[model samples]
Target: MKAINPKTKTNWEAIGVKPHIEIPQTNALDVAYKMALNEVKKSVSDEHQIKDINDKLEELSNSLPLKEK
Candidate 1:
């Protein structure tokens, strides 16, 4: 009996394989956080409010560890 090679004869579609789907690389939390930050910056016109926002952003950024290359 001859053995069939699975790699060369596999029907990907028959197994419900999908190649058209695109996955996002960015974290959803990061995207939502940036959107919220932008909206906050746009709505705050007072110097103190802007300063407070900047301070909070700086504090949060400093709290996270840097990613190594």
Candidate 2:
């Protein structure tokens, strides 16, 4: 297997390392993928809540006027 770092143009052999390894079991990989997907979904929900808070803050700021300078 060929391993190259694009930025540094270095090979794994040059770094004194082996790049190829055994593949992961299918069941373990599937479970990890599912967990990652759930985390991403939770993140998206949190982002929506943040956006709502920001919108409310902007509305409140617009409603209140600053004292004349």
Q: Candidate 2 lDDT, tens digit per residue, 1-69? A: 677889878786746654243234544444444445545555565777657655654554454333112
Model 1 C-alpha lDDT per residue in residues 8-54, reported as the tens digit of each score: 76454445545342224344344445447768998899999999878
Model 2 residue 10 lDDT score: 78
Runs of candidate 2 exceeding 4 Å displacement: 1-45, 67-69
What are the Cα lDDT values of the candidates? 0.58, 0.52
How do the predictions measure up, each by TM-score? Answer: 0.41, 0.30
CA shift of 48, model 2, Å = 0.3
Residue 22 deviation, candidate 1, in Å? 15
| Predicted model with the maximum lDDT | 1
- The clash tally of candidate 2 reads 0
Residue 11 local lDDT, model 2: 82
In terms of lDDT, model 2 sits at 0.52
